[model samples]
Target: MSEADARLQDMELPTALYESTDDGYLATALTIGPWDAGLQHAGPPAALLLREAERAGAIEGGQTVRMAYDIFAPVPVGPVRITASVVRPGRRIELVETVLTAGDERPLMRLSAWRMRARSDGAAPEPPAPHPAASGPEESRRELAAFFTTEVAYHRALDWRFPTGSFNSPGPASAWTTPRCTLVAGEPMTPLQHLLVMTDAASGISAVLDWTTATFANVDLLVSLHRPPRGDWLGMDAVTTLGGTGAAQCTAVLFDAEGPIGRSAQSLFVEPR
Candidate 1:
């Protein structure tokens, strides 16, 4: 844990969470999650699935409009396999399915995304309401949950700034984040990759429960984009709500320096750790 004590800028971070292999990838310490050192966080793996989904190809000039992921089993911090294929292909829209698996051939996670070709007539989506009180990213504070041991990898590998409530604060919050390291070694981080890697953190960043005593783990993540995002810095204005049935949900307005781009939702199972 001492290794992560140094601030991100003061320490050289690992380049990527996974290294591409013939079958899939090998997980590195950089992917460690907050809850367990042996399990990888959801964000990086979500990004990896999107990367492969896009690579499998979609309609010509297609843009990803929605992506959904389901995590049924723990993702181990070791070698894993991934595969992507087009499930529904058409001239105007397409759907892709990607699966990540660990040893024994059981899936660690399953994901699906929808892509659509731009309207040739230049039609656009209905505009979204502007965030009520978003300050610039520069005005945000640098912080995260203090109780999390320094050994956690994914959160520390990136820079986070809160323009509203912080990771330590239990309430609705807004923050800007950008990864300090590349998503894959010797490869570039695409716009979609940049956004996916950070969207999953919304539940943690705006958690309304004490993380030390309670567990609020998201079982799924869904992100819908109205337009392509620009730049590396991504922002989210998020909130979490819990029900009496031990079910919870987190919602976030996703954006970049340019403006509003999309929204993210995560479903959680709440219980004592």
Candidate 2:
């Protein structure tokens, strides 16, 4: 799933992103992307899948170290069927896969993750320091993505803070984001859920192509973390490079208030709208 800052936490979003029901998970308006109000944004649905993955492969002191998502179809803003299974079961490491179906039918996406045992006794080098000019959440400019719809949607669920370029500026960009809403109706977001929900939008905040004239869709998302992300604020220092053959890729360094935590990448199918 894809899409914020820490004291922005003070401004918690008014509603949850999705609701649970006997049939399946019901996506709320918050799940809508700007591109299509009828279709769901990739981020919230990604979070739903990851949440199931975490539950299916629960282990003591375990954490998801690496996660990947493959989108087979655009998610719709309706009931979603989710199923999770453990692919490889182990004590130290495990692989869990989750599949999402639209209205209990079409398989819309797949999520796979490696859950690893956590340890306190470890020796490692410190995370690299932020750039001298790296802007904190409060220091950055407040700029939302160019929404195809003006009504509150997925982009409105989070606060955006850009220290570098913005959606309109193009090229590489860096931003700090904080979610305003809870991932599920009744649950407080876990560290993993918090990260996955907003991590997929790495491309949107750092788009190299103009949104009005071009269409760039991320085919897949890959995230590798050195540690479990913490706090309410997460930052992405992202770069996108376009290829001549109608392809593009975005790579972003992920961060929390403490420092760098991990990285996320997306491969894009790009063309003019």
Question: TM-score for every candidate vs. truth?
Answer: 0.91, 0.91
lDDT per residue as tens, model 1, 1-273: 334465545756678878888888987777888888788889989999988888886577678899999998879988888888999988888999999999998988989999888765666756655543367767767775565555448776578888888888799998888877777788988878988888888998889899888989899999999888887788898999998689999999998876789899999999988
Summarize candidate 2's per-residue lDDT along 123-208 as a digit string, tens digits. 78675666322778989988866654744678777778888888667788888878778888888877678777788888887788
Candidate no. 2 TM-score: 0.91
* lDDT at 142, model 2: 83
Off by over 4 Å in 1: 1-12, 123-133
- Model 2 weakest 10-residue run by lDDT: 1-10
Q: How far is candidate 1 from the true structure (C-alpha RMSD, Å)?
A: 2.6
What's the lDDT for residue 69 in model 2?
94
Tell me how many clashing residue pairs each candidate has. 0, 10
